[model samples]
Target: MRLLAAVDLGEGLESVVESARFLQEGLSIPAELLHVVPTPYFEALGRRFPHLRPGLEEALSQVEKEVQKTLADTGLRARVLRGFPAQVVAGEALKSRLVLLGQRGTGTLEALARGGLARYLLHRGEVPVLLLPRALKAVRRIAVGLDDSPASLSAFRVAEAWGRALGAEVFGLHLVSGQGGCCFPTYLDPETLGLADVLARAKAHLESLLKATGVVEVSKGDEELDLLRLAKAREADLLVLGSKAKSTWRHRLGRMVEVLSSQSSMPLLVVPEATVW
Candidate 1:
């Protein structure tokens, strides 16, 4: 599959380079890089400065140089474009199998790559977008949220493949909630799975899913927050989940993925069931 990576040369440029390299080796795919120049803004400045063209060209040239230098001998084809960063990147991402970007921490303007652009793309079903952290290393452990739905099942397949490819451990996370505000218990077993038929089915499904997917560890959480806590405690390098669902109400799960992507420090990989992977 072709990978499209945006090189902003911003706060997380180094991490982006590393992420691209990781994908290159793991996915064994060709990568095409694009660096966007704020053309409209520069044009407005040129109207007044009368000498902005040289600096603009230099800025574009510098980004090209940095991307090439950092990805030396990696065979990553790259190009420089002029437009709003988000718009340009999203338009190109429409044709890619995956998109990778380095997301920054809490900051006003600096968070554009993750804040504005990220949220927009996360809502779109074009392709899977992998958001990398500002600091990164080789991926070793991957945690994937799971449910009985086909979407979750599809995500698990993709996550498991990545785990095997990277020689990483894969963990399956399932959340259980019941009436009377009951959530996942601190301890779990067949009894904890509950005596109800539905609960038994859920527990059975989870067990079967994890086993079939070759997930090394299985954990149950009461809520999404608990999953995040377990992920952090487990020192997982990446988290994966389905991007959307079939039902209207269930589609809200993607919102949870969006929230996890923004709050978690680790990279979040959302796999789409509709994707032709």
Candidate 2:
């Protein structure tokens, strides 16, 4: 499987590389480093000032050198291309099993473009996207959002595999939304299901779905806040959530995904519904 790490050479560059190194070493997978240059803007400038064309070439050459140096010791192949960052990364992501990127974009303009590149990939990209914050140094624990739905179960499966390969502990948090407090509720309010019964049933479902043993916490609260709280309380290095490309009436995993994509403070791994591993 291919692991693609897209870097912008910004403040988050180091964090992206750090995560890439960890994944490469821990998972023993081949990785690639890709840097996308906004060549169109440079070309526009070149047209406005024809004499500055040589300097633009020099700048691009320097960028290539920097990219190569970044990949020198990591055993990662480097590719410098020119295009819109989101489109290029999304297109290449189709061939990759997972794509790593920084949550914030490169420069002020990119950053100001709210939820710019990462959101595009999350909604349109075919592969799983892993977003790392600048402060992330390593991943030692992974917390997964769990529910009885297959989408959440699939996320746990991916997280479980990564935890085993990386030698990290995995935990599950099942938020019993106020809409329904029971995991196996037949109605909005199941009169027969008690809180203990809900927790037990949810834990059992998680165990069976994951086919693994770990701490699975079932609580009644908001999904997004409770998930973040669980991760923070556990001191988790990564937060894993499963998201669907399209919205459905019965499930709204994508909503939680979009909220956390921009708000998560730690590394976030989003497994797309179509992802196999």
Identify the runs in model 2 with alpha carbons over 4 angstroms from their true place.
Answer: 44-63, 66-75, 104-114, 135-138, 180-188, 211-215, 247-253
| Per-residue accuracy of model 2 over 90-157 as CA lDDT, tens digit each | 88898888899876643546545646777778776378889886544566888987776666777888
Give model 1's TM-score versus the native structure. Answer: 0.76
- All models: lDDT? 0.70, 0.75
Name the 10 consecutive residues with the lowest summed lDDT in model 2.
180-189
Q: Which 10-residue window in model 1 sums to the lowest lDDT?
A: 179-188
Instruction: Say which candidate scores most in TM-score.
Output: 2
Model 2 CA lDDT for position 127: 80
Residue-wise C-alpha lDDT for candidate 1, range 1-277, written one tens digit per residue: 5788887766677777677867877877877777776678767777889887789778767866765665554456777777888888889998788888777774545555457777667666567878887544677888887776566677777777888778898877666655432344223454434536445555566767557534534444455667678777888888887877333444444555756767766788877667546
Candidate 1 wrongly placed segments (more than 4 Å)? 44-75, 107-113, 178-201, 209-220, 245-253
* lDDT measured at residue 85 in model 2 versus the true structure, 0 to 100: 82
